[model samples]
Target: MLKRHHKTEALILKASPYGEGHTIVTALTSGGAQLKAMAYGSRKLTSRIGGHLSPLTRVELALYKSRDMDIIKQAQNLESFLELKNSLSRMTKAFFVMELIEGFSNTGVGNRPLFDLSLMSLRGLQSSSNRDIEDLTVSCFQLNLLKVTGFMPELYTCVECRSSLNSNNYNFIIDIGGLCCTKCLSGHPGRAINISSKSVEILRQFDKGGTLFSELPLGSTVELRRLLDSSTGFWLDREIRSRRFMEHMNSRDIREPMSAIDMESV
Candidate 1:
């Protein structure tokens, strides 16, 4: 049974201009489905809905069911994540998170845990002030995102033989989605990347729900980033676009700096 009217709490994933002054919004609903709806005249200066439809905003939406797309009749913002928006570095990471969410997520699927995890990750980003902690937040979010989406990498047992992993073996096979033992590495050939024991321990800690960034070595953090980023790209079969901007911003190596408008869009 379909209802004519619908209401839901959603996070605005993206919004684009539509015909005339309207807007096409893509939102991740609280019920865990990706929803697309039209907001008539939302792009106009006088439209009240325009302000609440920006990407990364959490809002309550009132929609009317239509044949092609749902129509947004009303919208009220719930969470603006103002602190996150105020910092450029945090905003870049947040955008990266959103991009990955869209890449791994599918429309019309019941994945409430994914929605909850997404919200939690954003909130975690909002509260953190340290750069190390911020980086850790995004990394932890990615790891949890993988787990929620059923792509969690096996950290303990050998992916090939399902045997207990030995202390000296720390090979993570990106294609196979887990660790490969020394013997299994021979089977996997060049497919395995040799991970340091420190990196492995860090990943294990994340897998076990540890978030404290204190005493975490920078090298290990970078190693984890490379591994997780590669795995995410491999699984999604495409490079995450926002990752480039995030890297650029972090390096602060702007020989060719982005314009103010360009920076704001990111």
Candidate 2:
């Protein structure tokens, strides 16, 4: 087979320093494949594509294919998602969005649905006005991501018993991958956390556009966040890298907007 030159639209997933002035750029292409390319001189002040290659920017790239990895020859920025980078909350959530996509994606496989989900989630997080909305946005994205990847947990029925979960008591069992009815709880015997019916209803609303976000109280948001955090953590088998930072910042009272410089560095 012969190597060829190709062009594609990609979102920069990672951009790390590689040799002296070159960088290793990992991107998720529009076709949903991971493209790892070396961008020569991208780290230097006067470099041509230096500004275009940062993580989370959408760009078109000219690549030369190789058995080892593709080499990026030219680049042009399509969108910087500057609005997302303008606030700490937005930036942190954006990073979390990217990390989730990157984590679930195969190294060289194409997953256009997952790719589109990532873009949509980023845009949603950017336009959100309040922290509550922002939190809902992230949870919505997580549930959709699970659906797209075929990991969505069961909500309406007992996962183990194949019976309807119409009763008042239901516990979400991470090990069994869904809610277990009170009658079925004794069968699996792993850690089961009791969940409220309100939480269940709200999570189920995710598949239907999640219009309940605005009406949800602070306690509901906290409950939903905890459920997602635990379920996602259980599935991924590790803590989300962006979670600690997001949680730490979330715990503080930074109601006033942060400076632009801090937003960029975040």
For each candidate in turn, the TM-score is 0.94, 0.91
lDDT of 2 by residue, 151-225 (tens): 899988889878998657868997678888878887767688887888888888897665636768667778878
lDDT of 1 by residue, 1-120 (tens): 979998999999889898899999988899878888999999899999999999889999999999999999999999999998887778888999998888877788968998999999
Residue runs of model 2 more than 4 Å from their true location after superposition: 255-266
| Deviation of model 2 at 238, angstroms | 1.5
Give the whole-model CA lDDT for all candidates, comma-separated: 0.87, 0.83
Best by TM-score: 1
lDDT value, candidate 2, whole model: 0.83
TM-score of model 2 (CA atoms): 0.91
- After superposition, the stretches of candidate 1 with alpha carbons farther than 4 Å from their true spots are 253-261
